[model samples]
Target: MDTINTDILICGAGAAGLTLAIELARRHVDFMLVDKIDGPFSGSRGKGIQPRTLEIFEAMGVVDRMVAAGGAYPPQRKYRADGGYDEQPSTEGLAPSPAEPYNLPLMLPQYLTEGILRDRLAELGHAPRFGQELTGFEQHADGVTARLARADGTTTTVRARYLVGADGGRSFVRKALAIDFPGESMKMRAMVADLSLTGLDRGAWHRWGDGPGQISLCPLMGTDLFQLQMPVPLEGDIDTSDAALAAVIAARTGRADIALHAVHWRSVYEMSSRLADRYRVGRVFIAGDAAHVHPPTGGQGLNTSVQDAWNLGWKLAAVVDGAPDALLDTYEAERREVAAAMLGLAGKLLEAARTRGDLRRGRETQQLDLGYRTSPLACDARGDDAIVRAGDRAPDAPCRGAAGQPLRLFTLLAAGGWTLLRYEPDGAGVVAPRKGLRIVTVGMDGELRDDGGHLRTAYGFAPGEVALIRPDGYIGALASDERGPALNTYIANSLI
Candidate 1:
């Protein structure tokens, strides 16, 4: 068997793995991504992308493509048994502000989201190897060695400094690591399919019936496809056959005019929410559905998984390059807590559907306020009362550069590295600059001048203060005095 060595070995090619791969690749981290499947995922499994994830995608340089490929959540039209229809909004609308540019959730197919990440990975000079699955792995003091098996009875040994399991809920890596996954498996089964259907207005997500056996047909954005979903009859075997699925749709809708042209993809799954006992074990770790699986009620599964990738990628890169190994410890500490909270939230949403029957999502689903305010990495020595603090999401504001060009705080953070926003007045200080850090002064004669008072209002910092932004667009540390060493000390202690 051939043996390959890499800095990191990522198992599975789902959103989490792909996001981790892209993050590592952009930072020039040596890694390999492998998947058990022969080709890309086909269906729109997790279609709702939250605003926080949109911000992460912006930093990754794929937000524009994703925005172009998706559309807003359509209004829902519930079809009653009496032939009358009732209309309702699927998602609540929020106005965009300087602090929060993406105020609403975006509706894009999950496959397209993965495709965008894969394309960006290709641009970064690496591509996921399909048909290669991590069958087993062994962890050592310094690194890990994994056994990868392909379809043709071929196998290979991969050695890496660390291994991440981005594989799905029944992840081989997570199981092999002996991580305990505890959750409930629902009795009700749902049948979901992507198909071509006619006689439905494209402007709304159409639904039929009520109670535990309701059906819905949602028009997928950027494609001529409709996603059909409904509860499977408890007594009979869930039929995935094309003819049976079409029949179910026709009978449920009670409309002969609506014809299912073709069934492209289909699945029969029970709603379940699970979280691993621990996210990490020695040199091996788990993320995405492998770490925490949601019921897909609030659309938190994929968004939380993507954020997991974002949190781990930078820390892994830094550790492999000689940062403190303790930094890696914070990943589980931070993400696992969020995952636990999300598990409860998703479960509540699922219960609301069962009892209240309200499927509309709200601001909480946007994940904008999700942060690491209590994280060990957040060192706030500013002594100033500010709305946005260390470990909070670094908000964006409109500003201008020295050459009279317009700029945005998000644009300044698109480079995928550390940035120091020095709020120096008159910009007359002769200060030493740190390597691999972009130091931008935000006052007169500085590189940036706040076009409006948005920066001051959003950041709540007086002049001469500095905010240390992490690669993931979170304020890792802050100092009230621009010349203070708090930022450097925090970086040296945490990220190096």
Candidate 2:
């Protein structure tokens, strides 16, 4: 009998898998990440790494290196209410939030981003177990048994406390779990290329939508070329020809002064915004594109995927370290809600993209920055209000923790422990332990000014009240009136 046991075995050694591997390593957890591709592909995938994502990297201890490898973009473009970007916030909007330095979008290609993450994982003394393609898995009473096809064509069994599928949309692990990924495909086709451009203007992201064709040209880091995202509607695959694609670019920019290089990569995806019905089944969990595949509207695909890995990593390690198994369920309950909302938002983005209408409603009202606001872990000061309140990813802000030293809220989060803060002190600290729990109560001065600021505005307060922060950056449960009981219950339950 051949059996290998690990705390976690992640399939798909892409961005999400490598990130999780790093997290597990940080927690001193033994895990393995596998992928079919052993080497990096030159093809340009994703380019824009939002500020929030960078903040996450900073927390995970990998941002400075990426920033050094790539340069920082001072300003990004902001499209007007009418499919146009002139002056709204491009270079003008500096994340208006004090908690986060939302100055510019960190410009790096997906491949380079992956390289940086792989390097970080190695620094933590773990390399991805490349060329091991996942074949299947069987979940037993105590552990999960995974079968993978090696590069030599030999099959090996890997047993683990749990399994995560960070593979792409067509995930083998998802199939083994028999979960359904539900969503519709829009016939919107786009030719994406990361190469030198002739006439695409110099800006963070050049968004030009007009009669012939609309194109988004974003300059990539380390390369003189810019990544061009040329859109072709569902009705007609207009640029089915190479010459036609060049013509489309010329028409959109109205500048024939562009030089073309060999196409590095090209794909025609039917922008299908989708999400899985369930994120967890038995001992298997799905994350990244495997959990939700959607159009790259808000550039949320990879961000959400990383968020999934972050949320699941600590919980998986916690369970392995003797925390109650039930703690893992929160991952599904929390991230799925976010993914479902993201699917809805993606559909809206596509609709707006197709109709080409008022972008103000889409940009301001959509509130991609503020939309997430639900989680029992983040229940309100009272009970009803807290449970039904906004559930989403927690925001980061600058703050003076119990230690009067200069610290970021994210920096204060114990690498692998729970964080509790008392935003208001009415009665939050008195709550009794409903179950296994861990919490820290930071006093917040209660004040409500505006859905008005950035991440700091979202989660910041003055002093006295409590703010409960989860390890994955979600609010577990907060209370102003009863501090103790609420604190005890939330943490005790999670720690069990």
User: What local lDDT score does residue 19 receive in model 2, on the 0 to 100 scale?
Assistant: 76
| lDDT by residue for model 2 (270-318), tens | 6787788888988889899998988776556777788789878988888
Distance from true location, Cα of 158 in model 1, Å? 0.8
Q: Stretches of candidate 2 above 4 Å error? A: 1-3, 70-96, 198-201, 204-212, 233-255, 357-374, 382-405, 422-464, 481-483
lDDT per residue for candidate 1 within 296-400, as digits (tens), equals 888899999999999999999988888888889989988998998999988888788766667898988888888898899898985556678898899999888
User: Cα RMSD (Å) per model?
Assistant: 1.7, 5.4
Looking at model 2, report the run of 10 residues with the lowest lDDT sum: 358-367
Candidate lDDT scores, in order, read 0.87, 0.67
